[model samples]
Target chain A: MTPMTLADAANLHTFVDALRFIGDHPGFLAQKALEQLELSGAALGIAIAVALPLGVVLGHFHRGSGVAIGASIVGRALPSLVLIAAFLTLLGIGFVNNMVALAVLGSGPILTNSYDGVDRVDNEIAESARGMGMTGWQIVRRIELPLAIPLLFTGIRIAAVTIVATAPIAAIAGGGGLGDVIVNQASYRLSGVLGASLCVMALSALVFVALAGIQIGVTPRGLRGTTVVHDHSRKEQQ
Target chain B: MQSHWGDTLQPALVQHIELTAIAVVLGFAIAFPLALLAHRYRKLEHPIGVFSALLYTIPSLALFQLLIPFTGLTWTTVEVALVAYTLVILFPNIVAGLHSAPDEVLEAARGMGLTRMQTLTQVELPLAIPAIVGGLRVAVVSTVAIATIAAFLLPDGLGYPIVLALKEPTPFKTEIYSAGALAISFALLCDLALVALRRALAPWAARGLA
Candidate 1:
């Protein structure tokens, strides 16, 4: 084995120290994790409430594909740091302000995916449903929605992971989460920063995995392996 | 307004572009080979995709903080995270693009007496340009947006002005709006450039689509 350098030893010490910090501050970490979940969960709820209906309606009509895609492009480009700062003048600081900005941040994928999901359902299927005397809403409710669930849930998963990951930025905006420990490294030290980062990472992964399970569970049995989840519109979630 | 543009916005824009460009290029350099490797070896594809996706699921801020212990608060930490972000976006697109080259086309290239290297370099890669560029556009735009977070570590990029403005007793509205607008515009501009580049690179493909 190669001899370890002083830097390597220091790095090892830092890692162990961070682990110790996490072990010692379970309550603090849990509280921050809860804050993160609540903030992200609220934001995601808002995003789904606003974007899903609009997407579904537009997609049902096969109109406003431009609007859906455009939202995603703009959303992907909008920096959370800048967005929270810009909203500072209007919304002021705190959980509501950050929650609103994060909702806006999370809305894009939900809108785009929901639209793509409904719109991409087979024309034949829709027409056949129409032939069977199904109304527009009925077709949407019964056929289109069932078919669209897989992709729509994929959008929510993307948004959930993104919101969870981004929830930390709320700390910078005075909306406390795990980021409080992360940004206050002067007080918490490097160990705390690293520990908080680990917590945040774990929290995001938990959100992602949980949502993925929910997605799998909710997807129509017929659509499980058939839906093409990857496409150009679905890019980097982070 | 003029003074702010001269003293702050201009420098911030340059730094943002530089930071974004470096991260995307570095990401491509690392991801391209890995994508090619994964494409050639089918067994590696799932693992590589999962690994990159795992990196991407971590929020940008947390990723930067995670690197603080190892790399300190330098731009390297930011770059590493930014590059990692691009991998998840780039790898799948490149691998998909590679697989997109039809077997008929490969057979034709082989029939023309082209070596495996020649077939890949001359035939397959040219066809993959559109998909590769599509990935680049996403990576570049996302990187441009995420690179702003580098300001939390260093006083550079458009994020610097936003952070600075936030630090004020009353946030500087002009600074925040200007920086935010610049970052969005920069991302859009890069995206438009990539679209134009794709059209230029694969005119035949564009024509086919048209």
Candidate 2:
């Protein structure tokens, strides 16, 4: 008991015990990671699906970027924990509620980035495409979407980072992940909590690094510099 | 009015705001100078940015849990973590905002015989208000959200109701509603007020939201 207590302390012993915990409960950590990935990946996928086209169209015509901007402001203000709990009372503690919260949160970045990306495309290119008798959709698909791809990916990266960081909180609503190990300190024991937290942190880091690699890989070499700077603005929302 | 366990709403809302305001003000105070230094000495950017990012990357729960051994579930633990989260956002925004002033505008100020410090205070800072205000809004909103988790540590602030309702058999409906709604409201109000404040202070940059 004493050694387990020491191991749970979130210190060097916790780190050592974290390794041991993972080794001992490989199945448990793997399942938790799976839950986390599923939620965030689902949330990110839905957010991009909804926000990307909306942002592109709005940005193309320059009509309602305000929606993206305002949503982000409101979204940043709503704490994920509270939102999840609120949804729990309303929707019952389950996957749907947590998924809804993450999607709402993640939509902000994707929409805003898509809007900014499409709006910033070189108008001259679009005009030339227009002069060549291309219609709005064709011009968009051909010129603007290609140009906006990097920014779109930046948005996804931002949303993915936010979702990964936030997904652990889903434990509160029984939308279980590493948060079970984090919040149920008594049940999992402190070493378990600490070890699970290390797992959550590692999961988030892995998501961030992997997505960043994807962002870089997708972006054209010439556009890479702009993409890097573009990422800093995305951080402002977080 | 009592809603189980003799808890009221006013104090929770007030404390949440107070806690959030203090952390943001203190965070801004510390981050500003660091931003200035980082901006002035280009060499400091990566290291400072990395340090802030490292602090920011610590998961909120892990951070609180890590501090329990030393701080013993105190406000100090909450404040330290809250303040640390703001640095990564604030430092970069301040630097970016300060640099937002056009190079020509800065050179003209220098040509006006304005000392470097005076130009920074007088010319550059005013120009930088938009970015600074943007950063402040993000920090305040995020802090409000994070502050709710403080209930687990001290049973204080809006988080108290939130934590209580979620944990105990109290009719959690009101508690969850009040805490969540108030937090969202606080964030929106603070953000809107900052937008107005930015507009009032820096009218020049009002050209299409700067």
Candidate 3:
């Protein structure tokens, strides 16, 4: 399809028309949104399951920091469209292909943040925990994990937003979502495209806000003040 | 198709670079002054930071489409969104870099009768190069990756082939792999170049003493 001129687009459908299109297809839009949420949620679940343990272990042992941080850099640098295309070739079109690709994409931040969060816990604090004769597992579980909640959630927030944003590409691989509307511009036309984009932006914002709330809720009040100290130390380390 | 792969990819590669370059340059052009302004006025810092972060949170695909009604499917639409993406990274880094020059250094510049502009130009900016270039590297690398999506609107980048292959009746493995590989390599290359730039721009920073 040729690109439309502004006048052509405006004449065809204004943003209001996009909203009306959305309103007209409530069930269809809801299904698309749910598909989007399911795919991203599943991918995020897999990523956290895999990355959290690995990152925390590495961080607890103070090992593989490079791998943790490096993975995130590469992950962030990856283009999601290309990722979906590449996966489609490997796995063929379907939900699995997109799910796996999204999982890999989401894992990076979670891994990096998990490791950094644990690794950055004050040495003196960890030492005191050790001095008190707490087991390694106990220290990691009771001390480091709680302290790392904020950064862990930061990682998750980044991953969730990224996954939600990129989930639209899954439609290209026949994994249905809002992308079905956004990418199928020929069938759905510009109104559906704009409407779906609005849905996606809303979904992403919702995910971010939800994660932020979880981060705050999970963060210990006492440690909240100390995060600043951690921030300062991080700057000094840099 | 095999014989013409080079011809097809060359223009796409050029377009990809052109888009990434323009966006990063324009993003920096806009962000640098905003960073300076935020630095000059403490009150502006929170708002500028919050606004940029909010922009960053908006998905690139959505942002592009959101602009299309007004901007059409032109490169301007893509550039505007891409520039917006860069601000979150660029503004914070530039502000942090500007603050990196210590109070002692600022006082030294002042004590030496250096004017505000002279102090900024000669001392602070020079000191800020590491942080500034660090942020620039991230912005460039991300822009390289994100510009591929612009091909959805404009058939002018590596993303074009990937999009084409995906939309094909039978997906084209060759196109998908080639374009994906090229984009990943391009991002890595840009990152390396920026790392080298940071070294050259602030040689002392490479020494790890600073």
- Indicate the docking level reached by candidate 3: medium
Pairs in steric clash, model 2 = A8-A191
Report the error of model 2 at residue B179, Å: 1.7
Report candidate 3's fraction of native contacts: 0.66
Give candidate 1 misplaced runs (Cα > 4 Å).
Answer: A228-238, B206-210
The residue-by-residue lDDT of candidate 2 on A80-163, one tens digit each, is 778778877877777988888788889988888888888777666777999999999999887888788898887888788888
**What lDDT does each candidate get?**
0.87, 0.80, 0.86
Off by more than 4 A, model 2: A1-19, A227-238, B1-6, B168-171, B207-210
How does residue A42 of candidate 2 score in lDDT? Answer: 87
Candidate 2 local lDDT, B78-132, one digit each (tens): 9888888887788889998987888889889989899988998998888888899
Please list, in the order the candidates appear, how each scores on TM-score for chain B only: 0.94, 0.91, 0.94
Error of 2 at A7 (Å): 15
lDDT of 3 by residue, A1-238 (tens): 9787768757566788899988999899989999999999899999999999999999998889679868877986789988888888888888888999999999999999899899878777788999999999999999999989888888999988889988987887887999888878889988899999988888888888788888788788986645623533544564
Give each model a TM-score.
0.95, 0.90, 0.93
DockQ of 2: 0.43
DockQ of 3: 0.56
Better of 1 and 3 by DockQ: 1
Q: What's the candidate order when arranged by decreasing DockQ? A: 1, 3, 2
Taking every candidate in turn, the Cα RMSD to the unseen true structure, in Å, is 3.9, 5.0, 3.8
Best-performing candidate as measured by lDDT: 1
True contacts kept of each: 0.79, 0.40, 0.66
Best TM-score among the predictions, by candidate number:
1
